[model samples]
Target: MPPEVIERDYGCGDPSKYLRAGETVLDLGSGTGKICFIAAQVVGPTGRVIGVDMTDEMLKVARTNAPVVAERIGYANVEFRKGRIQDLALDLVKLDEELQVRPITNAALFVQADGVAQKLRLKHPLVGDESVDVVVSNCVLNLVEPKSKRQLFGEIFRVLRKGGRAVISDIVSDEEVPEDLQNDPELWSGCISGALTEEGFLRSFNDAGFYGIQILKRDEKPWQTVEGIEFRSVTVEAFKGKQGPCFERNQAVIYRGPFKAIAATYAGEGNITQGGINMGSVSKVSHRALTEAFDEPLTRAQVMAIVSPFIRRATSTPA
Candidate 1:
């Protein structure tokens, strides 16, 4: 990483640690491309990393340092783009160039420009739909305006491929910030006022249809305290592959009692059979019945039939 990038980095945690090799990664609000550069190395030469930021200075710093990092690492797999994290489709740099050629000065021209932006979003998105294997962010989500936060999460979800995941590290509040604090310009700019409550942050991912959400890390100590509100850094991981049809496979899983009772839900709406008992949803059968049904060897055709749905579901492209 370049000294400039390190100097400008304001991240609360390292999301790159969660990334895997040979995976396409997108870094939201990737200031100075620090995380993007780190992710490029982790993902190796076969993978690609893109950094998106709305600030020209940040983009410039990131773009300038990208080649240096690539040269040092002996491969170039990272690039920086100019765009808002909440609206990943619109390339602000491209839009600016287009506007220069045809500046909007009137209401009619403004409407025309809006149409142009839409066309650009459709034809040449900065980040394409279901394109990235992973989306990672560091200390940036809290900086987005509250009104645009939903769109930000939706954009993250939109760009990720089915079965892909998002690993995000951001500041979360112990309690909701008051309107007075939220409206404070200094606090909002400092990444304090716009912080989501810890539960709200996870709920945002859930609302965006991400499953298997987990908090990878949460700081034991608050990073900042304002008006009795304790704000700390938390890293969360969430998956994006629960939008397919359910099939009845008559599968039953035993619950190793950590809890008195457990109920599980799947995208296909299946029930978990535990200890010869049906929990809920789908079909129910005793353990002996399930075992006896599959006790006989399955012919080749029967085996294919049994697994074909899973194979198709895994390979099918996301809409």
Candidate 2:
């Protein structure tokens, strides 16, 4: 990585460690391209890494340093794009180029510009659907505006291929952040005010229809505290491809010792409890069995074998 990128980088945790070789990766809010550069090397020459950021200055620095990193690594598999994380389909760079030709200076032109943007989104999306193998972010999710956060998660889920996963590292508050704190520009810019509660952070993934959600890491010490609200760093991993039809194969899985009662989403229904007892319907039990199996001392192949029949390619359009 270039010294310029390293100096300008800001993050709470390393999501690159979770990446695998030869996988396509998307780095959200990739300021200075630090994480993208690291991910490029980790994913190797066969893999590809795309960084997206809305800031022009950050994008400029990243685009400039990209060639240097590629030269050092002897391959050019990393590129940066300009767009909002929430709306990955709209290419802001392309919009800028179009605006230079047909500038929007009046109300009528502005409305026309909106149509042009929509056309660009349809014709040339910044990130295509079901295109990436992994989506990674480092301490940047909280920077998104509160109203657009749901769309942000949906965009992450949209660009991912079936069975693809997201590894995110961000600050989470122990308690809900107060409205006053959230409204403060300084706190929000500092990545403090917009922090979601730890439970809410995980729940957001669940609500986004991601399964096998797990906390890869959580800092023991608080990163910061505001008005008795403790904020700490946490790395979360969630998988896509849980949406599909459930077929009964008369499969049964024995629950090992662990939690007395646990809830899971399966068969397009609400929580199903399993309390150290055998459960049926392999197709219905989506996350709990897979999550528990992963928590145990089982290999990736073994874990896949356990959920292979249950896993199906998602057919519905991404939210």
Would you estimate the TM-scores of all the predictions?
A: 0.83, 0.82
Clashing pairs in 2: none
- By lDDT, the best candidate is 2
- Worst ten in a row by lDDT for model 2: 273-282
Model 1 off-target regions past 4 Å? 249-262, 266-270, 275-319
Q: Candidate 1 residues 31-145, lDDT tens each? A: 8999999999999999999999899998889989989999999999998888999999999988999999999999999999999999999999999999999999999999999
Question: What digit string (tens of lDDT, one per residue) describes model 2 on residues 199-238?
Answer: 9999988788787789999999999989999999999999
Q: Give candidate 2's error at residue 147 in angstroms.
A: 0.6
For model 2, the superposed segments whose C-alpha errors exceed 4 Å read 248-319
Count backbone clashes in candidate 1: 1
